[model samples]
Target: MTDDTMGRFGLSRRTLLRGGLGGAAALALGAPAVRAAPREVKISMQRSSVLFTVLKVKGTLAERLAPLGFTPTWHLFTSVIEPMNAGAVDIHADVADAVPIFTQSAKAPLTFYARERGAPSAEAIIVPADSPIRTVADLRGRTVGVSRGSGSHYVLAAALKRSGLTLADIKPAYLQAPEGAVAFDQGALDAWSIWDPFLAFAEAKRPVRVIADGNGLTSYHRYYVVNDGFVAAHPEVVATVYRALVEAGAWMKANPEEAVALLAPIWGDLPPAVVAAANSRRSYAVEPVERSQLGEQQAIADVFYEAKLIPRRIDATDVKIFQPPTGRG
Candidate 1:
């Protein structure tokens, strides 16, 4: 047939050969193969995610997902769980471990797909350098800034308990990152419980002392969560996204300079050195979530419940776990 006639068939010679081989193989197996329709996956992003930020900037995730008939639609959120729980996003990037605990307490249906190993030192409670507060106990009766359900909140609680105090012992100014930074800079809050790169930014620009970090208190794992319904309906898409995250994390760790270069401008033009310092505190090793490793999550949930931060107690490990493809870490 002529080129125009062949073009009307909408099949190239190579494509025909591949299709025939596939058809013969399927017939040999006595089953028809199937392919899913193209799908759109809404992924959540935040400035805190150095890994996803780099991946998003590079646009490599889209290229990686294209082969699987999935398109990525990224939505930026200051906090991920609320929007993800509201059905605003399908895939949630890594968020502090404590975030999911609160979501679970609220009965949000989310599945844990992957986790970044604990980088305990990534968050801390900071006081002015010359402040009289020299220890965790000093925080009692002091006005402290903290994001209510953030990882730093749990760290603050654990730190205080170690020093014979509780959330009630202090006057907590429940503030988001921006508000917390402003309050801290203006000396309205005695101390701020926060995580990087905010932690890194504040330290670089201000005179502060870190009274405590998550080191001995919590692992501070960052988790990737997916809406439960989406998890069941589009497992393949979830797996692809998981693998892409794993690869992106690995790439960032391997190329520190490039990673910082990509992150600096995005982090409000923060100095590269500051960004590097913040990144160094995080463990970019993404792995599948296991029930046994959830001890810290359970502790966070119990602590929050006891502190009356969450309305109800939750079994942290009761949520669904999405297994990555076999042979993945």
Candidate 2:
């Protein structure tokens, strides 16, 4: 009953455990308590991540997680999925729907935590004003520039499919936004598939014609993903991060001018007008990822596989979806 009595009986908790009882049994008999170690939350964000930038600027997530014994570390990435798959990132700010499909195809353990509502006009296939390309059909046999495995890549695929064509119909130039912009500008590419704020930047800098956007093709939903291990280890941290993201999105939408002013310097010093235009096309409403709404994700996966873009086909809904805590802690 007491430490003195147990010692007098030569039956201390450790002695009992050594006499063949287990740790749990010994704990039930009043063993010393164990403490969990503090965790480091590695959050990854792309340069174009407006809401995440807002969070970083305000240090909102860090403040929220500090009380939970978590130290938040932010990492900027150009290609986020690779770092996420390599376990270098604990939480990804957000990426296009096609990004997850590609990561899943590679067998990376990922969990969808939150999703931005679909913004159909956020990305498009554009061509120079003087170009002969008029519709998606005209893109056939032309050199099209797009980032490999990116959201705009899916837009290109869906747009081509709608016109009874595929990636093979065009000579694909796999390039990042800057490279694609250069190629498109130098009269090298027949068409370029891109997303905002790069899309807005390109349109403002030059005279271009939009052949197609995500309107009837892809939803262009951005998703916040987390490492499976992180989700299992610190669910509370995940919930906190998700709530912070939702709040940041709401703030960005509510205060457009302030959002632009805050983002302009961080966004390569792009003009406020360009930032506003880009922000206008995006729906920053963050919500849970519903299983029923993953139809487009499945479609993106199937299309990529059909076009031999991914190594193998993946079940879009096979990954985990995190639900935030309902009540107070």
Candidate 3:
């Protein structure tokens, strides 16, 4: 990792916190100090999300929240958008930075708290080793399997734009990462747009070649989103988890091999080298979301809108950012 990236966040940085429950208000006003809600919370992620998967396997979130009295229930989902909108989890651990734009357009009551900056090289478009596709231009009339509303989706869009083609130029196969892998291997699709861990696995186990990756075309930032209710109910706990994630991110960077080993068991016994290859491309530098960082999200939204993938134009930053909640003494 570069010194600049490492310096973006460190374990030494404390949350900019100042918030409290009505208990504090009650104390100040001399009324009954109403107890806060139960400390239990739910977190959700799909295996496709690398950081959340690592966090789940390491058991760090549970460990971090223990002192805070949180009862964290792990919820597995096919994708985050559904569970997030359905309120199945308080924390939607990591979803593609582009996804929330579509969700926001749908008016889901979710918000962004943390975001891992772009590691565009981590996401790519792969073709079978022997395929005749020589360039992004060659993909013009081919079928490409991709996860809908994913960073990989944005990667494919950005890559295509550089080739002077659009989504309409190719037969887009909207499949989840796993399904895309199967399709690519079985030749059900002409090419697969995927992210690492899965991308690394495909390159290792399947005869594939990266025809194009997201470098120079996109910023593959992933977001740690939360249910709006969770923020209102337990802002302190949210801040704590955010801190825990930053620490975990640092740990991942400092010890990549160990991170790979830790993730092997949870990722359906993925080979450590494949996991490591995947890990190599990621930043894993978790940071608080800022309005400035969100500039690319607007471009992502525009990409999806032009593709007609999203129903309408939406401000990518319309959802609230979880500030270090400020409160009365």
Candidate 4:
């Protein structure tokens, strides 16, 4: 068993093999470990959201994430799907429930990581103060402004079904929020299907009426989405961002006035009162995405597919849903 005894025997083949094996094992165990690549959490921002602005300006999110080794960066965006598809953003703060369905149908590499509780009244179908459109049924044969596959789209669809009307019953003027708001103001549109703070902005400056809102019509569960590439590579970073958002959401809900004050200057100089009114309709809560949420997402997908708005049918649950870090360390 002694090295000197083995050497005295002039090195048997078995002993040589044992010594070689020990040396190799020692080399393998002594090797340094390779570190994972550093990742940045690049998030897309929107002035329309209350939490995102507050989170960005207050820097509370950075403080929370610094402990976890990440600091999210924000980018401006107009649509939920475009910037992500073009590689301009890594995550979107609050995408509508119906958007990922269209992205999936288009074969975009995207997934949902976090979701919001239903805030139905946050979006609605509005008309000018003096317009003859008194109910959802009154939209018949008239042009209404809408952005296809948005939460507003679902609000319009469900409101129509309740009124015994369908998308075919009215002419759709496909437009985003600002452009749509402009059309509504200039009398080029009979009605506009929009969400807040655009909803609040329109009401604050113009004489308009909400004929029908999402209160009883749409799912209204907005989501946080990530690029498939980003989630695959930086799950922990994504999870960190999600947790920061959860924290920021709680802070905003508990301190509405502070959120409004933090957001007013960032949100196109929106008055604090108007910002407060818009934030009131929102749930300002974040929860993990699960099967219960997927059902309405499937309904949204089927509706869009049936209308030929999306090229193909999609299973909403097929995409990635973030499960909180269950000690995945």
Which model scores highest in lDDT? 2
Q: Per-residue alpha-carbon lDDT of model 2 for 100-203, expressed as tens digits?
A: 98889888888988999999899999998888889999988999999888999999998888899988889999998878888888889989999988898888
How high is each candidate's TM-score?
0.87, 0.86, 0.84, 0.83
Candidates sorted by TM-score, best first: 1, 2, 3, 4
Q: Give candidate 4's whole-model lDDT.
A: 0.79
True-structure lDDT of candidate 3: 0.79
lDDT of each: 0.86, 0.87, 0.79, 0.79
Report the Cα RMSD per candidate.
6.4, 6.4, 14.0, 7.6
Clashing pairs in 1: none
lDDT score, residue 190, model 3? 89
Please count the clashing residue pairs in each candidate, in the order shown.
Answer: 0, 0, 0, 0
TM-score of decoy 2: 0.86
Instruction: Give the number of the best model, judged by TM-score.
Output: 1
Clashes of 1: 0
Per-residue error for 317 in candidate 3, Å, reads 2.9
- Model 4 per-residue lDDT tens digits across residues 111-225: 7888888888888899999999898899999999998778888788778877888899999999988898789889999999999889999898888888988776676888888
TM-score computed on alpha carbons, candidate 3: 0.84
The weakest ten consecutive residues by lDDT in model 1 span 24-33
Taking the tens digit of each residue's C-alpha lDDT, what string does model 1 give over 250-322?
9988999999888888888988899999999998998999988998899899988888888887888788898
